[model samples]
Target chain A: MLGEINLEKVGISCFFLSYLVAFAFEVTRLIKKSRTSRALMLLFAVAGLCAHTIFLLVRSRAADLPPLVGSQLDWMLVLAWLMVLFFLVYSLLDESSALGIFFLPLVLLIVGSTYFVGQEPRAVMEGQHSLKMAHAALLVFGISGVVIGFVIGLMYLVQHRRLKRKHGQAGGLSMPSLAKLARWNRLSVMLSFPLLTAGMLTGVGLGLYSQRTPEPVQLLDPVILSYGVVWLVMAVLFGWLLRAKPTAGKQVAWLTIWGSGFLLLTMIGLQVLNMDSWHS
Target chain B: MNLQVVYCTHHGTDLTLREKLAFSDEQTARAYDHLRNEFPDSEFVVLSTCNRVELYTAQESAKNVPTHQQLAEFFAEFHKVPREELFDDLLERTGPDAVRHLFSVAAGIDSMVVGEPQIVAQVREAYATARDHRASGPLANAMFERALKVGKRIRTETGLSEGRISIASVAVGDFGKSIFDRFDDKRVLVIGAGEMAEETLRYLHAEGVRDVVVTNRSIERAKMLAGQWGGTTAPFDQLDELLGQADIIVSTTGASRPIVSCERFQEVRRQGDPKEVFILDLGAPRDFDPAIGEVDDNVFLYCIDDLEATCDQNRKVRKKEIAAAQRIIDEETDEFMQAVYHRATGPIIRNLREKWNEISQLELERLFGKLPDLNQEDRDHLEQCFNRMVNKLLHPPLEVLREEAREGTPHGLMDALKRLFHLRD
Candidate 1:
């Protein structure tokens, strides 16, 4: 009966299959390009995005909560949905650059991870107050910045490599120059630091508030400590960037990629392992 | 239709041949008169530039059209050059290739600098001059107008002309622009009178750099170069002093050794204003020391290599655009071929349709005379049914002929259609 039912059994696979098709269309443009082909590529992407949005909405409705706050199923799809939205808007503005080459893999990773990662809701976050809700929202947004910064830095390095080697700009694989990428990376760190700091502060406040209630929240957990360390690294980068005379765009891009990339890996690793303070 | 272009382009000829064959505006008018007198049925438009000398001719029939050898002979006689000397340099393209070539040239896809904006203006000027001399026909008018539209489309729809790809331009437009908002107040010091130096000075002048000081190893050369560009000449000995005062320094000297050493430039930097300075080193071994680029944050030094890499990147982008533009050309070529083929078969198709209708009318008239008691409405309905059946029977063969038109003129099929359809012309 469960296998035969369409809504619960088939929605996730159906939406994900569309994304795979859209990704294939984006790749196909490199070989056979036409105005119609380009439009079709966009059409597939929008189609997949519509299906993805619907699937997530249905899951949230069935679970009776905001998608990201509901369960692992909701959280993973929400991240992927945001990524697709960002890629679609940005790619529409500048169709020449290969933004999909970098961001699509991340979308796939999140979508793929949902299969392995369980869908149990964290008991602590089920009926959290407004301040606790603010903490989770801030953390998600902050992590999103770090993830984006990593991707941008990776693109900068690739562009810089092409320039340094004197190779022609590869067809269907152009990106912004190191100069522009570095500027974005620096801004990302600047923005991510303040948001992350506020998120951490709010988290601490929520923890203290929850300790007075029955749960007795732990402040010195490993996940909390690792997050603090990631915040500290961003703070250092931000301070150095502001004080330095002028760093080369390439050097800054490399540093941001390395630093932010490590933080992102740790965050994702924490989520996957379900260890440290973040365990349900 | 007969269309021909006798062109000495950069592909087949050198600047010397182009120059010898080039016709100024007054000379072009005289040539037009000569052409009209020699071949009254032909239409002519002469395109003369620093790089190309082309004479395009169009006529209603191929019999009056000039051959390749005849065009070469004309060029020799007109320019007073020997026939042997000019014969090899003149290349010819006829009919469809000719139209495609002209379209590419007007679009700048065939230019040395792909997608350069100047060629469109050159083409427009050439067309206007031809019109003024009464040298163009309906075909030339239509062809040139369509070429202009294609040029506009290639420029606006594609990123073919997005960046300046020359070293002189990249240095001034990219790095210089990033440093200073305006160059009108900047002191431009050019350290050589080479072609590169002249080109850099021209760009600077266009950017409104007024106070240009030219210094070369040869003062006479510097003075001559500066005089031509309307700039002051400085002595070779005062190169360091000139460098100190220059807000923007462009060195294209042919010195084997480094002209501006790290220490020498640092010394000049000490005397100069502590403000930012833009240096363009356009030498092979590099006129300025490579370490000079790292001397200070204010000194924005770009050597030939850096500017060259950027130029090369832009060339690659243009190369990509060529593929897109070629696709458009191929599509247009097929459509043009179809139209020309259909025009070729127009007489036979019209005659066949008229002949069939006459036969149907005669047979119907015979039948109606035999059956005079039949009603007028019934007779008319029978005639309509018979006409529809005739059209349906002719449809399949005619469709094949139309499809064949997309290749060449479809001359074989047109002759075959005439025989089978009992079409007379």
Candidate 2:
């Protein structure tokens, strides 16, 4: 059925087309101020979001699992989904137009890479218990939080720089103030730390539980080692935030962005290389 | 009828010229009386603001309205300024352009802080005062009332007033209010009596801040500023004590080093309620260290750059409203021109109606006298029929005259109608 429909191609292309329409609509707001233009922009965004959701749902159905607990394609889709969800929620909260201007390109970059990258399904334990699913769910949620933290941190630094430079807010692009962005960055770190810990704990339980199987899980694959290293760095940032006397918000923003960004890259690279520890 | 405006506004003239040209209330009333004496046949309304000085005049003849040079002379004589000083600065617009200009100014489209609401009120006050002094007639009255409507339309239809577009306004309006609940309850400490500080203090006072303390390096200057604003002068040495007590600290001193360092402010914050304090450091060489902004969650310190950055963003948002405002101006220009043309043709219309009605009434009476055998009901129906015939006969020419008025005043057509119909002016 999936082969006959080419669901992946249709769904992805439809969402991209919607984004194209949305971008054009948003640009028109530069020339004229109208509530109609704003409404139309939001309309196109929701359309794109709906198409993106459908594509992921179809892919997950083909793989016979929830999208987050499926293949590498599903993992990247979850991240994109999280990012878009954040954009929609935040844009609605404040009539701020800056989020789409900054984050849409990143979304496009992630979505674009899905074309060239591997979409093959990972091998599940022959008789998979629900614990493995729980483990994947926890990890997916945790990674999504880290991605959010990274983006918000990037925003915080940009806002901090603009404020420090005294370069007034530019047209059509308004970031949250330094004070608000700092608060968001701080909250993201504090929240992501606990979620990430739960994710690691769940993964460890899955690894120990799967060890009794005929093909026992290995603990020291590059994916696991890299995950450990990334998690450790994030822990250090978390600890510093808790102890440090109010540091400059920009410095904290940059550190969080780079540190979390590094972890994300390594994790995605390990997946793209198909370096799962279960096979090792 | 013809209308014209000779003016110099915030855009065309500097503040110095505007101040010199401005009319105080008494002066404005006297100017209106003088204008009546000088140009007895014309209608006049003088609009004066901190940013602009405009005189709008309307008359039955373009020859009667004051010229740019004459209006300049009027300003010179009225304000005791030299004509040579202001003649080059003043500009004039006549007819439709004049109408459009007044509409734009009244709507705040020509404002220094575009979309500000004060200009509309100023326009209303000008018109009212002109009426009070019997300075405006039908044409000027129609123009001003329509302009007020146009101002209301622009505000309701556009997002021009959605954001704070100035550093002084946004800092005090957005972030400052978010930090403090009320300004009247707080003690405002102004450091370095510079222009930015003065401007910020003015906005603060406008927001109901009364208990202000001025501290500067120069004692005399501080005292002078404090005296002007009804605030007490704090000695320069007491900056630390004042810093701790001030709920709001606005620093625009041209200091070479950090006037309020993190260490200095942190000690100050300890003595005060640790809830919240708003500090606006507007100096170029950095009066307060940026590190001080990081001292606490409650201490929200914004420098000139930060506040200005928000203001720049607001300007972009405002730029989007320009098209909307222009559309309003265009619509209003059409409406006003139509009304003015109709007014120009009004007397002829009335004379034509009266002449035709008299002929119809006389013919109906003659017909009734010839046929007394007809019933009273039939005579009444015949009277209605003749009145309808007169109206039907007049409709086509009236329509053509209206069409011609749109292009212009229909001057040739109007003269022809008056002669052909034996209409009296």
Candidate 3:
């Protein structure tokens, strides 16, 4: 049976089904604190992650490029895949936690949105392959940080509300202490903003380098401008976080949600629109 | 065997009654001496705590076992309480019910704060005291040991005792720890030297608090409390300055009016650098004004009502684990009862076996003498065959006795076995 099964034929449906089952198991665990459910959830998550990894590798091989620069579809899948990696690791380490309930839906959103985005591979500018690769890698890692920041911020707000309302830790919705969440949230933004800034700076460098080549890229591209605007918003948030005294955790959580949520939305929305850009 | 417990706990009796009925160390020793004189064959153990006063007694014979009214009368006479006033509050349990009640108490399922852990140690200490005074016999030892084991099993197998349920602990652990990362570096200022304040300080001290300044209207009381925790006393008139200096404040005064109003706290905050302040107001009438919490983002104020709300939520969470805990208790109780019942059949079974064995030996010796020409191997084989026949004959009645013991003591079955086999107990 194993020899007869074809991995190349595995579609988004295969991994999507696995993740849905895993998420359902997470929900069941909350209702009935069962170690079996938690173990099964992890099993399904690992299976889905394997299939997802193979799918991305196959797509990258077919395109003759890395998945990060293959297409908007591949980029979104890679991002989703990274998040699944995070979720799986965290779930394995903390078996009783219900983080998958919060994380899996976002993964599904990104993976599902890949269908509407462009699938055709973009042309790699001559002698600019490495630079473009660096740009894409930086942006992916940076955005991954933002995604983590958003999730931690969400957890912080939840923990804050529970503490403020004087409700003990919710039965299955246990989270890190407010102090720990605040620290992690601060670290996420502090680290991600610099990487994002570097990624943007590299993109500008790529833009400048591409102008010297025969296929000169426009400096005033709408995609580039939109990215710059998003970067500025994050930079402002980053600055506020650094300068502000350790404020109330709820305020920090709200700022992180808005900042990271905007970045993710703009990045995915711009790519889906297929705006003319040197990278794509 | 007969076992019973007469008890008054927070569930059915008020603190005043429990206090009046409670036994101190000296009283417990004196009571045990009196009990030994009054009832020579009985075993007694008294468990007295702030929340409850329980007297457990076990006897080998039902004729000598203490009745509910008698135990109540003993309590009335011993504590000098009027019989009518104390009798109604004293509840009684016997036999299996008594065993189940002890298991529940040791496991903290019967506590006012369900799943509190102090009851386990309290039960253990009570048993130790009883043993030290030579008041506990073999039956009481077996029962109390099993109760302690059941308490440990419940704690490990269920999440009943996983969270803090006390008001002071809930305030410090659930809310205070959430605000600040470390307590050792924070300055702690206690506003009053009330019991609640000292309790809160105890919790904080366990969290590694070092810098503590206590201020109360009575300087001597403040000094006493501060000296207890290795802290220094501060003048009550310098409350605002101390408030500005401290990061965490615990106020538990008996004052009828709010001590720290919003305007006063706001002024104190303005004098200090903008930093986080965690305040626990444990007074009933509200030591700190409720408006102080809304005055600024830095002030994280929680009063007794807030802590009680958290405790209520924790109690509900603990309540969810009750069914699981009850299942464990039921299984343990049944096992213990079965053991006790099986022990009751021990003497009859032993006598019956010995009587049959003596008859087999006599008959075998006569047969060997008659069959002198038989080989040694054949003789040995014949003896084994006779032993198997005797075992097979005894199996049915003994099996029935063992089966009956599962439900109860099987005294009637033991008596019938004794009569049929002509065995003496």
Each predicted complex: what DockQ? Answer: 0.08, 0.07, 0.34
Model 1 spans > 4 angstroms off: A1-48, A110-116, A125-128, A155-168, A177-179, A246-255, A276-279, B62-134, B138-165, B169-250, B263-279, B291-302, B305-335, B351-376, B382-425
lDDT of 3 by residue, B167-212 (tens): 9898888788777778899899998899998999999999999899
In candidate 3, how many Å is residue B133 off?
5.2
Best by the lDDT measure: 3
Q: What are the models' TM-scores?
A: 0.75, 0.72, 0.84
Better of 2 and 3 by TM-score: 3
Model 2 chain B, poorest ten-residue lDDT window? B173-182
**What C-alpha root-mean-square deviation, in Å, does candidate 2 show against the real structure?**
6.9
| Docking quality band of candidate 2, CAPRI definitions | incorrect
**Top-DockQ structure, candidate number:** 3
The interface RMSD value for candidate 2 stands at 6.1
Model 3 residue runs over 4 Å out of place are A1-74, A84-101, A115-133, A161-168, A201-225, A248-251, A271-280, B10-44, B59-91, B131-138, B153-165, B253-259, B283-289, B316-328, B350-391
lDDT of 2 at B48: 90
- How far in Å is the alpha carbon of A233 misplaced in model 2? 2.2
